[model samples]
Target: MPDATFKIFRGDRDGGELYEYKVPIAPGMVVLDALHYIQAHDAPDLAVRWNCKAGKCGSCSAEVNGRPRLTCKTRLDALPLDQPITVQPMKSFPVLKDLVTDVSWNYRVNKKIPPFTPRPNVEWKMDQREVDRVQEFRKCIECFLCQNVCHVLRDHEKQEQFGGPRFFVRIAGLEMHPLDGLSRTELLKEELGIGLCNITKCCTEVCPEDIHITDNAIIPLKERVVDDFYDPVRWFLRKLSGKKH
Candidate 1:
């Protein structure tokens, strides 16, 4: 209806500031449209990383009004237009420029996860329910919004010790797959720092895919980590067998 004011971050890893731009709102206009308008008419040098302006690409992830969201799917109508909409890079990652943050750290964490190893001499068949279980994890678009929102990474800066929620979801798919033989509970307990998560469910709240990240992926993984490392009976058995998780 009226013009919407956008306070978009501008600059690089060195430093940056929010430069305001006024955009005339249109019906069905999303935040990305306003950003494109700003790019064309106001600040040509503005660096906002985006692709496929639809929600699926996840390339347009940024903080809108201090909440991590995909700008492409964030409808301007849904936001309060009376005040300036603050668009900034995800705080969990280092800003490379404007709204773009360096997300390569996610890739590095992903590399640490072992690939799916199917059990030997196993039937290729699996129950439909089993397929459905892991399929939920496959929906992850790697927006890294979960990682950005997670307190472990966002607040504590535990990148060296934690793999963040995105990787936990990836590990969930591999670990839960009926045919997968490899066990990543050790990886989860040690490298990914699964114990660090307090299950605030902030990651699930920000997920555009609505994949139940907390209930389905992270919690079950936490249980696996506990069962493997904490259960008294399991601990006793491991000790008796001279085995280490």
Candidate 2:
């Protein structure tokens, strides 16, 4: 019924600025709807990305009032409308234009991890509990909000080093699979740089799927890396035996 002001970021990778707009609010309106209104009424050049506005596609992710969220799922009334609703592209990725970012780096990191390969000559059968464990990680919609919130990726700019939480969840799904034979500990340690995580749980908090990126995925993977590389007794034994596996 009343007009709400929005400070939406506009620009390319080289430069940008938050531009203000006024849109009349409607009952049960979401932030995405407001942005669409702005596009129709004010700035036709406004760039934002969305597909399934029902929140299943995860394509509408953006920082609303500086918090990573799916704009389609974020309710306008939930925010303080008296203040300008600040919407910006995810800080973790380079901006392509407006709220759409270049997320191709996430794909490239994903390709580095090995695909799921079942153990040779083993039964394909698995317990329901095991299936349930990996199933949690599988719920991810690739919103990349977890990745965007990760300080290792967002603050430290470890794109060349860390795989971020999304891939860690993927690696966790593979590593925890009952039939999966291949070991990604080496890959996790060397390339993905799981050690750099520091168990902040920032990734876990932002995940739209409610996947436990820290407790279920990252901590266990960290433990495996520590055992494989950092255990002093094991290292000593390996040196004594002069064996490399």
Leading candidate by lDDT: 1
Q: Tens-digit lDDT track for model 1 on 1-245?
A: 58999999998889989999999999999999999999999988888888888788889899999999999999988999999999999999999989989999999998999999999998999999999999999999888999999999999999999998999999999999999998999999889899999999999999999989999999999999888888999899999999775
For model 1 the TM-score comes to 0.96
- Residue ranges of candidate 1 with Cα displaced over 4 Å: 238-245
Q: What's the residue-level lDDT of 175 in candidate 2?
A: 92
Error of 2 at 176 (Å): 0.3
Alpha carbon lDDT of each predicted model? 0.93, 0.92
User: For model 2, how does the per-residue alpha-carbon lDDT over 21-86 read when each residue is reduced to its tens digit?
Assistant: 998989899999999998898889889999999878989999999899999999998999999999
Name the regions of candidate 2 deviating beyond 4 angstroms. 235-245
Best by TM-score: 1
